[model samples]
Target: MRRPWGLALLSLLAGVAAIAVALGPLLASSGGVHGFAFSTIGVGAILIGLNALRRNRRAPSAGVLATAVAGIGAGAIGSVAMLGMLVTSPGGPTLLPFAPAGPVVAGSTGQWAASTTQVTLTSVAVVGVGPTKQVVVGNGGSVRLAAGYSFRSATSNPQLDVRLERRVAGGGWTATGIEATVAPNAPLTAATPAYSTTLATEAVQYRFASGTSASAPVSVVYENQHLYTGMAATIYADAAPYCPNTAVEIAHLGGREAGDYAPGALLIRISTAVGVRANLTRASQRALALHECSHERQWLNYGGSQEGYAQMKAAAAADFTVGDNGAPPIEHAADCGAMALEPNGYLGYGGFCTRAELNEGARLLNGQEY
Candidate 1:
């Protein structure tokens, strides 16, 4: 009897549909490695079975049908593997979804550490940056960070004045300090300032005085910090750095918003500059992030809005010592909230809003009514 090849082809299509339905949740919960590997194997096996059926198009026999059946059975191998994984583990579906969460104490950097100022800054800033990365996990996690940087004088006749700097998640890069003893034709013993950061790695950057290098640093000797499991807000670098001196997203340009308020999700905003070098310090970039985090809390916790933020700031200033016209209420309240996250609540009290570089970046960093 001639084999009903059309019926077999339909079976292959049906099997694919069934696999998608059955494997979807498993693939999602399979935690990346096992899920991806086994899924590929399973789907690949089914495809192979279907292809074999197609090759013997002329006259099909019982032997050919048996081979097709065997191939199709191979696809079931994934379901078997997934079942094994579920049976082997005590907790059926627990996996490392993100960095772990746990208890944490904010850092006490004492007074603000000084850095080279590109522009006279203002009282605009970001607060509670360290905690953004130091998450509290239940099963434990690691935040890969770098402490110090090492460099070499790429120039043969090197007139090198090297400085080391670091920035954390979506914050500005700050100059740590100049290196010592970069002698003639020796190893890259010059030290750059040591700084730590997290994978919001978009904002995390290391600045070495290789102003004219064809390549930028893509990798770092990152150190990791173990953490417990839970969810928290984190800042990530924008796809493209902002146009020079433009803070956050250019709200005026089109439909994109710098930050937005929604349920459960926190929107932390940051400023980006492209070719136009922003005159900013690491501290200022951080301060800017803190200010944005405050906005996040405001949006998530409270309904963050222009009118609402303004009203709240006025209320807060009346209760607290919110300085003169130097820092606008919206910016000032953000700074205050940012400060509250510090070990010493007032560590960055006036750090961000009280600087000169606070001009365009400041007014626009968090979007002030000023």
Candidate 2:
């Protein structure tokens, strides 16, 4: 009995072709032009694949041409996915530097006052890059970690502590302990209580307490020798605003720093002045990016899609008495985008922007005065 090799091959090719069809939308959302092209080919492949399967059941050789086309489509999709990853990876393209950089080291001197100290970082370096891993911000001066995560275990316990953690491969950071309670108001020699917990860590977090004036500057030292890697630090703005008529490149932002106001979104760009800030942390930057892009999306979607509706919202939103009844609904949506994208709320970029922030984001998105 001869095995049905031809039928088996057809099944394999069909399965891969289906995958390309599914990945098409994801690719389009992630990269746009390149994605769209890949998606079109993928769709075409599915059609060819169906025909090939039909012919395969009749005469295997009859499906050869279709199978070849299907394979090309599958290859096209795979190539696009790889290209998108490379283009967005950190240190890839500057304009669309989508990948987050290394983790940010908060304590310059590894010392935080006996107050509330919280640092949300990206990762904990498991590999080696530098020697500035353990951050202990003490009184007088500050300690700084270059941009990665590396820690030394603590020897004893104290009253308060600034915990640290490492980043998980998926996303978000988690904490275990620092081997000792780090008293921010007591001496390094001071010991309060003995706490014990056996847990491994991935990401890092800083914890600070409030309502205490014991005059004990926190003394944090290294405990373990493990180093965290792939953490990204803050990235400052390189250029001004994206001059609408300009092109994009990797080495250059061709835009502004801090808050990237494409001089505000579409219509907002027309009515509102640019509102780019400086010194925004990565979290804030992500939030701002999400908010602004939401505007651009809505504008291209609703405004461009329906000029009459756009005119009505533009006119009604100006009547101070009525304000904006979701006019250019993009405003409300942009706020939501900011809330969703922001991780640490550094600069109010993430979850739940205040009323003021919502208004501002919405205003800019609506192309109104802010």
Candidate 3:
């Protein structure tokens, strides 16, 4: 029997993941200094750890120390490399040189829509180029794309345009005629479109013709839909005004993933802001309001430090699944900070947990074990 290419790829990915998991602790200990370097180190560490652990208990060998040193050193190098990459171009900070929050630009298409994977086919419409990022889908049927996805076009008609039309479940590929032309190397602005659409959280694929140069289909992630509800309830139980009677608003910020304001609420940019609208889940809205309100409180109380911390928390909460409707995750550190601070029973991103459950979370944040 012949092995499928997908299976082979999966095996390779699994191997990589195993390596990453093993090295994660060492890399994490470095405080993510090497950006994705730790991830690579983690992979190496995992491979080493597994081999050592399986080799039967002995008084620890030079090999173990060697592996540890290698992992840490690699992690350090990765950190420096990532920092260099970040500071070397217009694309660093992801949200740095921040513009008013809007939609993220995907592929060469100047078109922006919020929902489902914003699949782009290079053959259909070529445009700008850089990272060639892709969209992330959410558990709630929302789709988000990272600003990293871009195209470069020096052609006379240097336009990056692609459309992600709705496809019938198990049907034909995305039709080619619906494609659009994207503006090249333009600063994303308020004039950007909020191309919003509803995504099916169930598994879906980006359909492009064979031999097309587009990247693979990235899934949207639906984070904490269940936990988000309970968290909102806990927050609104006390922080009512900010929690509003309705759900909070989320919008895609700019070429990069980020957040912004809306009428009486905040918008988490799911994809591009083109035709973007507030598509908040009942829980997501409440949690965001609480989260944003906390930001306001942080600004009033602690100033820059607290404000920065709050932003980090919001970013973590904003991380999406395979079909999330926001831009790629931003400010995850802030999210973790907020999670540590708000140790009540709310699962801000997912849903709710009992007071006991949340208390456990608090302990975990505080470095205590139940």
Candidate 4:
């Protein structure tokens, strides 16, 4: 009797295809190749074992029995691996049976709608305001959040309550007393009224929630105004677009340099002279901020502080000069990045950066580095 080699080969090919699919980033999410490979290999082994068992069933050979045992073992291992992967993978299928005794409940309502019903918070933005003339003179300010939500339901005119939540210091979310009701009557999409609140010293996290659904949180950092004043604040704000998360600080550097970035701390410290130079003209200030922020971007592009520092140190060592005529590669790259931000504006090291440096700076800013 001929063995079922064709079927076994097909199963093996299918396993290989599964592995390819898993490895392809566009093909799968969350679970990587290992899980898919293990599961598929186990299934293939089981199929091969079953084919071998059937082929010699009339007079079962030792080889057939061994193959069956091996197949069962592989299947067991694959099942375990698959279960672990699924359990750990976010938004993946579950093996546990979900048997509901009653209709699914959402929020406080028992109005069971089809599974198609969904409420999603789509967009969120922050608008900040300085102190008003009518208000008492102070350094404090306020910010208003505009949140938008979308809803869909199989049932007609399904309504849901959207709530704005802020993360508290206790690592839990609390409602900000901002709520809005949305239904299909309003065409299933609406923007909630702006929720205004006083600014805090630290950055705040906020999100919009509707029942069990929630939007991704946004962090509002007010450090630009709260931590900095005068020209420092202006420079920080100007540089913010280049590196939004990097913190800016004004300090006395005793004429060492215009500005310096601490990659480990993700902070940019500007010399008092830089701020003074910045106050001379808006273009100069913007150029200075852009240069410092470019350093932060460089750190980000090189991965993190450790790798960035190491690579930058190597580049600096290979360079000839740190003066305006010729600076280190890192400084040259930053100057080039500043040029990328303000192509027509005054750059401190404008004459030093080469065409390649300018292109590299632009590439880093655009996240096009391969």
Q: Each model's C-alpha lDDT? A: 0.35, 0.33, 0.33, 0.52
Question: How would you encode candidate 2's per-residue C-alpha lDDT over 1-370 as one tens digit per residue?
Answer: 1123343344346547545544443442333344445445444544555555555555455346455455546645655554553343221212101113321112233333433222222222111111223332111111211112211111111123434333333444344343222222211111111221122222222222123211112222321112211111111121012112111111223443233222111211111112323445556555555554544443333322234336534633442122134223334446554554453544322233455545554454344433
lDDT of 1 by residue, 1-370 (tens): 2344544444455445446634454443343355445455556556766766775666666666666666577466554654554343221222211111211111112232122111111111111121122221111111121112122221112233334445655566666565423322221122223334343222344434334321122122222122211111112221112111112221232332223222122232333341124443444444444555554444322333334545555554543344354644554555554443331323233544334223422333243422
* TM-score leader: 4
Candidate 4 residue runs with Cα over 4 Å from true position: 1-200, 203-229, 275-279, 312-326, 349-351, 368-370
TM-score of 1: 0.22
Worst 10 residues of 2 by lDDT: 231-240
Q: Global lDDT for candidate 3?
A: 0.33
Which candidate wins on lDDT?
A: 4
> TM-scores of the models, in the given order?
0.22, 0.20, 0.24, 0.38
Candidate 3 residue runs with Cα over 4 Å from true position: 1-155, 158-161, 165-172, 175-181, 186-201, 206-212, 221-289, 292-370
Q: Compared to the true structure, candidate 2 yields what TM-score?
A: 0.20
Model 3: per-residue Cα lDDT at residue 10 = 33
Regions of candidate 2 where Cα sits further than 4 Å from its true position: 1-64, 86-140, 147-370
Model 4 over residues 137-215: C-alpha lDDT tens digits? 1122223333444433433233466676767444888887776433221211122223223452345566677775776
